[model samples]
Target chain A: MARLLLLACQATANTVENEQKSMQVAAVDTSKVSTDAFLKNRLEIVRVDKKELPDGLLKVQVTARNVRTGFWTQLASWFMGDNPYQIAYRFTWLDIDGMEVETAASTWIPKTVIPGDTVRLNAVSPNPRCKDFTLSIRENDAARG
Target chain B: MNTKIISLIGITSTALLLTACGPSVKRIDATGNEGLVTVDEVDFKDWQIAAEKGINSLLASGVLNRSDGRKSILMISTVKNSTMQHINTRILTDKIRQALLRSGKVLTTTAVGGNGPDDMASKQVRRLEEDDMFNQSTVQKRGTAIAPDMSFSGEIVQQTSSQGRMRESYFFFHMALTDLATGLAVWEDNVEIAKQGKKPLMGW
Candidate 1:
């Protein structure tokens, strides 16, 4: 009788564990990140070597630094993997006379920013017609994956 | 006379014994091994690291997105070998091409490269046949040129310095992706690898 009762208890415990796991899995949401959070992590455009790209392409480098530091909750960082950090940048183009070119090519690119590290992102404009430009940066949380 | 003979025998035996005991002891040159050796030349590991960095930079910069509709087509163009030795530049270029293709943002030439397209001659033959049939059937026959959106070109340069037995080498690899239409480079990267060695020794 005791053995049977123990088996029944084990079965109940297994069912509860599985139900809890399913709940956790169901709670996970693969949603798009927020724009404000994205902007906060982005790079601050310090300076551009040339403001205008004559040939529709501009050669410029953006300087960015990682300013976040703290004891990580996922604490195997010393051996398993590094703390995640990302540099997100976007490029806005313009015509020779200085007008925004709203095209599909304008999108954010995520760059790996090492922890407590500063990086420079260099770019050469590929669009021959793009003359003036604006560059923006945001922090990327996608690097954690 | 007897004493002289005995002396000669004794001297010869002693000389033989001494010669046998001192079997040509040559010193091992340990100046190179005296300390940790650094390689001054670009090695396999260096190439690996540089290639990785270059790919990362290219991906991060979103240079390939410059094509029409944020989609770009790439072709493996000229990769100049500026180094002393004859190296197949394809090894490095191929890796870059593969990575770019896998990134889902860029498309590379699928045509097999012989003097024509496709790795297999049979596939090229089939494609040609299909094109010919299509051309014959169409009222307005037009030839579609498979022009690359961007052409990749680069060079690898190497430098070496030696002092006595110690040696150092540095290799710089520069790469650029230029738009075929405008003759403008859309992406450019430089990777430097340096190594040092005391002397030439063959072991990993």
Candidate 2:
């Protein structure tokens, strides 16, 4: 009985560790826009565009393309190339001093897109002090929150 | 009681007890994917999504940046809720206000607005000029308060339809920023959210 309990505890710990790793790996920064998402292997970041508007706010537009796989790899019988993934993204604004500039709209925004399609996420600096930004992308779980 | 009635009562009590032993409450990221969602209601995540979309549109419109090279003064106006749900409109406006403030392109007037002063202290402090307890030199002058260059207003509308056992809802967030002097909308945008779920047999 004691040995069984130890094994169960180890299994629980492993599950927790896997969850943490998945969440951490899910976030892909714009600086590493070339890298694909570890959270969902199908989603790939194709292009990243950054510019300053007339009002001196930094705007970053990230384009992500979804790559599709077979039914066996997806683990589903239905495979018509229309499978959609709910993805969430958040933007963090950093000032000249490298401090985060918090805005009320700094919450994650969720979007649903099908594989073989592209998702464009755009965000502007909430403050003029924010000269730099970091974008985090992850899979959105609607009912989990 | 009949056997059917007795079984019904026993099942109801057991269900209630099970519900009472539901999961414990815990804090989660408000903007993340873990928020509660209802097919017919405007959830917190919905408001967040709408507010961010509205802010992005407003900023990208370039209406806040005037040709005079000065920050525009803005007044917060009423946002009519035409939806069935009772929504605290501030949850939507406050986010836009905060983002605009951070952008440094617009300053919201607290002394005057469509619904009157946001901060009553603005007027109460100025009223001290009439009082003798304080020096009148430090008091705010009448002409010192600047008028807003633009007015912000919006409406939340919803449309619902049922198809078989599934119910679908579409919420539209329509917002506009008007030029106070020109009396014309300088910028306008709309954000829409569509959700469909299996309809419950009972209450909404």
Candidate 3:
């Protein structure tokens, strides 16, 4: 019975492979993420550089340092020297109208930062109309995530 | 009494094992991060995460931005897969292609390529001129086809190593975009994915 069930699932997966799942994206509100709200990600914000590329696309670079540590995290990372400060970040690109700009690269990306280590999160606007962006960060949920 | 207790423990253990067999199967987000991971072999999640880097970097390269008030035409030259896995290269390029199309900076060519056109219909449709049943005026006029302005190519490679009880696998996705007129690589990017795990004392 287990073998029969597995084959049926395999067949369904093959049929669904060519189809895409629908997704919804919400716009980024400047009112919520106004001045200094980026610090809520638990990482210390160091610097932000923004400029218009030769192609007129907006390019932004965020330099941040890992500064937060808990008792368990320190014990696992400092004492045992096993874990590092791992986090995942996603960029929310926005148009001038404050609407979300959809792009394949907008998905969450994972990163690892050792204590006191500085990292740079760089992004180039996927579309010429992308004029603004907001970043969302959270602790790494799983190994691949 | 001792015999009865051992029998009781054996029956309880058997029931627990059967119940812990886990679900048969389920569906998940193909592009999401909920996919499984392993220290060996490239999985769906690996391909998605790896392709995401290529798309982001390519758009950031500024090579696709045309100054002539026209979208740059792109051709997929060769994406070599030197990995040990029996994988198709399109799994990586298709995502990049879809992203670039959405950006509106570049349009991929389908009329010509190194390995022949991806879609033969453009070339085949032109052959309609030979059929007298069709209107000659409606046939696409000669010299209306556009040539590619740039070529996109890359390679994916894998490396493996083992130390003590830990095993590691590293993959590098290297890509480049070349200007056909100048024959110079205008943009290049390399993305890496590393996986490592320690083996248990027993089991394959």
Deviation from native of the Cα of residue A12 in model 2, angstroms: 17
**Per-model C-alpha RMSD:** 20.5, 8.7, 9.8
By TM-score, the better pick of 2 and 3 is 2
Q: Where does model 1 exceed 4 Å of error?
A: A1-145, B1-42, B67-70, B112-123, B126-145, B200-204
Clashing pairs in 2: A127-B102, A144-B34, A145-B34, A145-B35
Which residue runs does candidate 3 get wrong by more than 4 Å? A1-42, A69-73, A76-82, B1-24
Task: Give the CA lDDT, 0 to 100, for residue A136 in model 1.
Answer: 55
lDDT tens digits, residue span A1-145, model 1:
7544432332110000001111212322331122343223322233344432332244556555554444552243322223455444555555555555544223345466655567775544434454544555544332333
Fnat per model, in the order shown: 0.00, 0.76, 0.48
C-alpha lDDT (0 to 100) for residue B167 of candidate 1: 75
1 or 3, greater by TM-score: 3
The better-scoring model by TM-score among 1 and 2 is 2
Highest DockQ scorer: 2
